[model samples]
Target: MQFHHHGYVSGDPRVRPAAGVGINRPAELPDEVDVLIIGTGPAGMLTAAQLSQFPNVTTRIVERRAGRLAIGQADGIQARSVETFQAFGFAERIIAEAYAITEMAFWKPDAADPSRIIRTARTQDDPAGISEFPHLIVNQARVLDYFAEYMANSPTRMSPDYGFEFRSLSVSDEGEYPVTVTLLQTSGPNEGQERVVHAKYVVGADGARSKVRESIGCTLAGDQANHAWGVMDALAVTDFPDIRTKCAIQSGTGGSILLIPREGGHLFRMYVDLGEVDPNDKGAVRNTTIEEIIGKANEILHPYTLDVRNIAWHSVYEVGHRLTDRFDDVLPDERGTRTPRVFIAGDACHTHSAKAGQGMNVSMQDGFNLAWKLGHVLEGRSPESLLSTYSAERQVVAKNLIDFDKEWSTLMAKKPEEFENPSELEDFYVSTAEFPAGFMTQYAPSMLVAAADHQELATGFTVGKRFKSAPVVRVGDTNPVHLGHHATADGRWRIYVFADTALPGATSSTEEFAEWLASSPQSPLAATPSGADPDAWFDVKVVYQQGHPSIDFGAVPGVFKPQVGPFKLADYEKVYATDPAADIFELRGLDRGGVLVVVRPDQYVANVLPLTATAELGAFFAPLLPERKAAAVLSAATEP
Candidate 1:
């Protein structure tokens, strides 16, 4: 949203001026690239969108499909994904068009009748208020379209190459572009023809039956749950009272239905339980018809009826949970000795039942996590070792997701009478609400994630979790805003300094820290390339524990007023004060002595430290960022 920094633009600011490979980009696929992505699913599209910001890094995506996906099976958008969309600058636009889930209604068989079902419990969505953004219901295709638009408008002008299917690939131990890929044309005049391309790194965002994953010797290792469910999106007249609301209904017998209201008001989706599938049955459950699904739904509703007008989409799938042994081509024995050249993400690495509505949301997070590391390593901002954290961090999260979905899916398939407690399902739903909302992920301590030794500095902003935003007043314009909303998906580290109650010019902790950060070679700010924007590699912002009127703007430290752009204009938006309406200091439990919070490019809190812990802060970033002397050597080596 910050435009006209380099120059004026009367047209859309989203459509950035193309540079590097984006300038008059070749219509034909290039022979070599920095990063090559396969498939245009949620993981692939988001990967391309994130890498598009780095024009200098040549990134290409290829999809086997002839064109964009018309209808996507996934529809649920969690709060965490909405927060990510805000970073990419499209959350508001998508939310305006998508349906916002507010409450969930649970229905159970009536005791008196035993045939008819009655609403037992109604619980609020996100009862814990984990995120400011709401859980949404939007088509997966539309989400892909938004990322596609972002990619098309990015500085790289990156977009997927349709009709290219991955045939095979091999990685060389020594080479500039280590991964040599063989792509076959799936359509057009060049159908059946194969072409060769090479890349420094490759990402497999292809679905469960990914050839890339197979080529890397990784296999999904899990079995089916022997449960089958029939899902359909329809337009119908339903006598069921909670049809418009998200509902979980368990019948007197063994039937059940999960009713979810879709976007565009009238359309809704129903996942009707189709009973258990026998282990010997070889996909016989898939042949279940729309009429049979509707019949099963009617049985779950008892006296209520569904007069179907039209069926938008319908499919039958057996619930299965599977995850790959590893996400990358690096074997266990060669982990520390070798860097990964090929990586898998999304369904390629982990898969589970779609009923939990996590297939696409978790996949997007996978891309967001991997793409930043790719951008950093390829752009020489970070070392190759940074690539190792992607698999280490996301694998744990995927395992946790599969475990939770297994329990949730089982409860949905179970009969009402089978449970010891009648309200077990609803109670479980409320207690574990944060997981489905996509706030349960907490990356364990590693090289990228610091230990929670200083978590008390900002209790609300938990270490290793997403940086929850709170209201702050922008001192420059006296406008109230969520502090976290300013951070974007441009792949830059964020350092937030919460100043103690001290005057701007006074010799306090904040002033001394800022001066050190502005001058010291040990500071991460010193790593910024010469003649570039001062805040290019890192975005440093300061928030004070005081009102806007009480602050002195001119007396603020030079570090906060970074000189950016060609003309070196002082960016004044970096300084902020706590909003009196909602005090961030109190909301996030900031220490009165001041605290320094370091957030990764993916928006997770990387480290939290005290104001005077300058050496500790520098040590945290030292291993991640390249040293000045080493960077100079790399620059010379890369020169033509």
Candidate 2:
């Protein structure tokens, strides 16, 4: 909060840039801005891409490194993340170049061989019908490239400021910027000089050794796995049948090897855990080289030999789990006496083994969650208190991740002999097979999500969990589309109306829904012009159960075809009724014809209600979005 030109105003970024001003342009390191992000990794840049949509808020991303990473770190994109990419319109770009990892085979100790392990378990890597996209194995560098390209092309035209290293930080009400960030120009065109940036909010996406975390006085809690592993990315020549699929090999005596199939000219990544490391050392640094790492891999798979033709990247590091006590903090002014105001996220908040392929995915999600909230506040669309949910929401997720990491990373580090019961490891895999996809993460009820009970309306689609999606064919093109496609992370709410045209009086009920939606003071569509523009605050769609001769577009309510947003019944894109629709109703535990679900920008279900709750719809959006002046006027005119 700051005492500004107007008395005591919270720096709500959502407050749209005053009346006719165009989107904020790339300013020359202004002393004040909206958000300052550190690091150029996926998490940091993804945050930038999210901010790109809100051209009103100013953002600057700085990296100590001179340029972007080329190869060899974080390659797996989880199903949940793939869905996120699809929402942003880039999942196809990644899917085109990535290797899909759908199957896994685990090798355990063989009593006869004594040296090499034998296959003991094989399972599908992803849950069936959980998501439309599969887990994709593409290099982190390639992912970053996609994010960077997207951000650079957005209205904001933003990119990372390279060769700028963080120096110090503080918060001040009197200064031009609420949060002041000091930087030392290490290289690039602007070198050898000090620069300062003042921002309304700060995101510490600076990786494991986070300077932002230190500035906020946040401390890491948790321990590292007592194991050192050498990871290598390479184009290999091998006799392994499962080389293209994700595989785990545990040697009877030596070590364990985890194989991850990759993109780029047929490459694969191997994580060779060489066993126990000095617990106190940060990385368990050893005098090991690439050749030694490959040698360890050879021992794990004795019969299936591996010869690397080109090594993309190699690194040796100890496995560990650590998380910051708090995700955000306040800081004093440069004089060492003021309020704290810095926040940390991504690797700055938590660090764990990368074997599960969660480090980058979770980090990118951290940015995804914070970006919208910050955008809302900076733009004055929501209260400053909305900012508080960032830590509350993400920290729980981080803690859960650390708990799972400690167990999985430990089991993964052990040699076959180290395991007392090989079956226990398999049990662990089966029990938590769906954990890697990241869809199970549920946020506690808060300001954004209602504490309301929705069990009777839709049983399986819980309030806090992600909205379940299923395949359905569009009425016009007859093209099949995922129901989840409507929940893009583009900063708008979604109202999915499942209307069954086959039922008696279904048309009247549908018309009533649209009428109540437009008339209700709390309706989401109340804010949209004629409530039909695709670019409005909210949008709606109907899912007719029966298709073609059974129920055509003509049967839907004429009211459903609002000429407001970009879509209408005439377009047929607004209506869906097709084959294979039972999967959705079954998964959602719906009785027969339909279900109405309210989905947030992040794709979490906020409320589930039957069509009978049409009047309650306005009440749902009342707390979620800004109060509607149009609603107030309508209420006044209708008042008895």
Q: Pick by TM-score: which candidate is best?
A: 1
Report the Cα RMSD per candidate. 3.2, 7.2
Badly placed stretches (over 4 Å) of model 1 are 629-640
Q: Tens-digit lDDT track for model 1 on 296-351?
A: 88888988999899998999999999998789999998889988999999999998
Alpha-carbon shift of residue 425 in model 1 (angstroms): 0.5
TM-score of each: 0.98, 0.87
- The true-versus-predicted C-alpha distance at residue 58 of model 2, in Å, is 2.0
lDDT of 2 by residue, 66-91 (tens): 88878738888989888888767688
lDDT of each: 0.91, 0.73
Give the best candidate by lDDT: 1
